[model samples]
Target chain A: MKVTLIAGSNREQASSTQLTRYMARLLEEQGFEAEVFSLYEHQLPLYGPGEAYGHEEVLKLSQAVKSAQAVVLTTPEYHSSISGVLKNALDFLNSEYFEGKPVLSASSAGGTVGVSSLGTLQGIVRNLHGLNCPEWISIGSDQRKFTDEGEPADQATELRIRKAVDTFVHLIHRMYG
Target chain B: MKVTLIAGSNREQASSTQLTRYMARLLEEQGFEAEVFSLYEHQLPLYGPGEAYGHEEVLKLSQAVKSAQAVVLTTPEYHSSISGVLKNALDFLNSEYFEGKPVLSASSAGGTVGVSSLGTLQGIVRNLHGLNCPEWISIGSDQRKFTDEGEPADQATELRIRKAVDTFVHLIHRMYG
Candidate 1:
């Protein structure tokens, strides 16, 4: 299965990207192909109503999500909500791209747990007509805290993330198989 | 009294902008000095966490909101929520500008009334520590449909909008007077 991941932060080399990369590796281990779409790396202009299909970046992201068997979207919480960059990308497409796709949501937090952003994202997924997996990954501070060895400092967060991913993978497998 | 209005749409000459302009006029009539900050005219780059202070657009908007006695935010609903452009602009600043201010939110809908976006916006204002006025302005299609002479087709919407504006101004006067 092919999965598309969205790293929904505008910071350079953000923990949101790192987290998505980690998610991709785990999906790969489970016999899935994955690609990370970094908002920081591919900056789309502010969304324009009735004009997204003409934009290059929107076309690319839309194509990736449309063809994928499942999607994983990761965001850094901003002011108790999903980052505007992520929401902006999502605003460009609608049910056409997301319909019936199993989407797993995760958040790259800023010190605290990203609970509110996850709630808002779930609502958004419902609006997009996507099948939102109930298991959420709110990257608490420990999940992104890196040690001097350049690895996440805590393994407990990893286990939590794995469980969510495994559940999402199981959900996708049930749909396609 | 100063009231800062945000026209939260990226479209050129959007109805969202027009709605804010109308609100500004109403506030001006109520003896409140009003300024409509057009997000469409002043395009902000996607927000970078902890880096907004350096950006010119952010500084301008933050200064405006900080100095204003009250605020009126208008948006176009997208995906059953506030437009990403509006939320993106908001993600740049926090309670430093909005603290203790009375914020009245309005939305210029695509076709239906933007009730969900208004609810979401109220939650965001609360997160920013602003006092959210309970009365909301959910601009229905009648509010934006223009006549041959460029006036709104339905005067009923104007009356509703005026009521909302009156309620907001009353709340502000209670605070400042």
Candidate 2:
């Protein structure tokens, strides 16, 4: 089965994207076909109600998510919530796209703790009608967590990320495999 | 004194923008120079931390908000919170831009009641160090609340908007005038 990893930031060299890459590798190691959908490549127009939903990028993104059996979402916390780029991408989709799919929420923040964005993402995922995995990954002071090559710099952080990924993968198998 | 009204959606003829226009007019009627800054006209790049803040549109938006003594922010509720476009615009700014400025929050939603986006906006404005005016305007069933010309269709809704604008203007004069 295919599991999509969405990197929720457009910034080049973002820690969130690094985490996404790491998660994708982990999922691949677990025998799943994993694809990383980076927002850096998509310059989606701002979503406007009543406007034509004809953006090629949005359509492509919608299709990718729809085809995935499960998704792992990673975002950089901005202003104590998920980044705008991630939220904007979600805005392009509706409950129909995510309904019944399992989503694993993850985030990275500059602070010592990364709890604030979890609630926001949970609320948004619920609104999208996606089943959020009970296990989540949050890396605080994220700038110090990753190396220049986008790999975890510390073993402890890497272990935490693997644990979260394992739990999400287990849930996916149990629920939909 | 200048009071900036930010229409927090990119949809052409959006009810959020209509409400913003209405609020701008009310502020003008209250003897304040009010300008409406519609997101429909801006195509800002997604914000990236640690990246060079060099976008011309972002610079222009920052300058506008900095020049204003007060601001009235209106957004459309999406996924039970403020639209991503609005949040993206805020991400481009920091506390310095909105510090000490009084902000009046408003929103429109498709549901029977519009309360979801209010808390989210309040938290963001406070994080930016802006004083959020206690009075807020929320127009629910927004599609039915406005006429073809974008004016409030009913006297009751118009009255509510005017009252909220009046309260906001009063607070602006009291706090920053």
Candidate 3:
């Protein structure tokens, strides 16, 4: 099973990136092939008709989202919501792209609201007809959640991630099969 | 008086951009120095810690936003909210960046709900400490509502634009002066 993790954190050392990486690893450990597409690496133009008219990068991005079997999005909570880059990427995509897709939306940030943006995003994805996973894994601003090496630091968070991954994998199994 | 219009529409010929340009011209006609910062021209990385550490481009963007006396943001509604690129640019800004600045949020989109995203964006900007003009402008999607040159075609829409600009300028005068 191919699982695409869309990492929305715009930093090299972002907690959101670390969280997405951890999710990818957990999914891989469950015998699923997972790849993360970091928003930082993509040359996304401000999404609009300009880019919609065959911008090579936007085309590649749309194809990536379309081809994914199961999609996982990790975004930071910015001003009580998800970052704009993640939102921009999503804006360029149509509901047809996510129709029947079991998408998992997760968020992490510096404060206590690890998943504050999740509620807003969940509403959006639901509007797009995406089958969002019931349990959203939000890693609240637990500064000690990540190790010095930027890995998940706490055992409890790690275990929680494991359960989220299993739930995601099971959903993919039920939907795609 | 200075009114800097940040055209958030990424499209080469978008109704929102047209409205923004029209608003800028109208402001200039009213004896205010108006400038339009097309999002398509600005090269900002997605907000990240890398930029937070004073990346060159990030510094330039920060300075641009800080120097503006008042800002008019024109965005297209996407999935019942503002576009991601605009949101990303806002995310990159510090809270104090718009702390005491007057802002006018407007939208032009295809759906009847195109203006719906403006309220959400208003909430975000308010959270960021911006003084938003409560009387917002929204153009419902109609190809005929746009001119051959992409300016607003309807007389009523033009009247509305004038009223919005008048309100925005008044708000800036009242708040800043």
- Score residue B32 of candidate 2 by CA lDDT: 84
For model 2, the chain A TM-score is 0.93
Q: Report the C-alpha lDDT of model 1 over B1-177, residue by residue, as the tens digit.
A: 899999899998788777788888888888889988999887888887676667888888888888898999999988889999999989888777876577888888877787789768866875675755646788766678755543456888878888878867865765565
Q: DockQ, per-model, please?
A: 0.02, 0.01, 0.01
**In candidate 2, what are the lDDT values of residues B91-171, reduced to their tens digit?**
888888886577888888889756689768866775675765656788888333677676799888898888878767765
Residue-wise C-alpha lDDT for candidate 3, range A19-126, written one tens digit per residue:
888888888888878888888877577877653637776787777777787889889888988999899888888788776576787888667665568867765775
Q: Which residue pairs collide in model 1, if any? A: none
- Give residue B131's lDDT in candidate 3 (0 to 100): 57
lDDT values for all models: 0.80, 0.80, 0.74
- Superposed model 1: Cα runs more than 4 Å off: A49-52, A147-151, B1-177
Cα lDDT for residue B53, candidate 1:
62
Q: Estimate, for each residue in A1-177, the C-alpha lDDT of model 1 and write its tens digit.
A: 899999999998787778788889889999999988999988888887666667788888888898898899899999998999999999887878876677888997767688788868866775665656647788766578755543467888778888889878876775576
Query: Looking at every candidate separately, what fraction of the true A–B Cα contacts under 8 Å does it contain?
Result: 0.00, 0.00, 0.00
Model 3 DockQ vs. reference:
0.01
Error of 3 at B150 (Å): 48
Give the C-alpha miss distance for residue B112 in model 3, angstroms: 11
Model 2 regions lying over 4 Å from their true place: A50-52, A142-144, B1-177
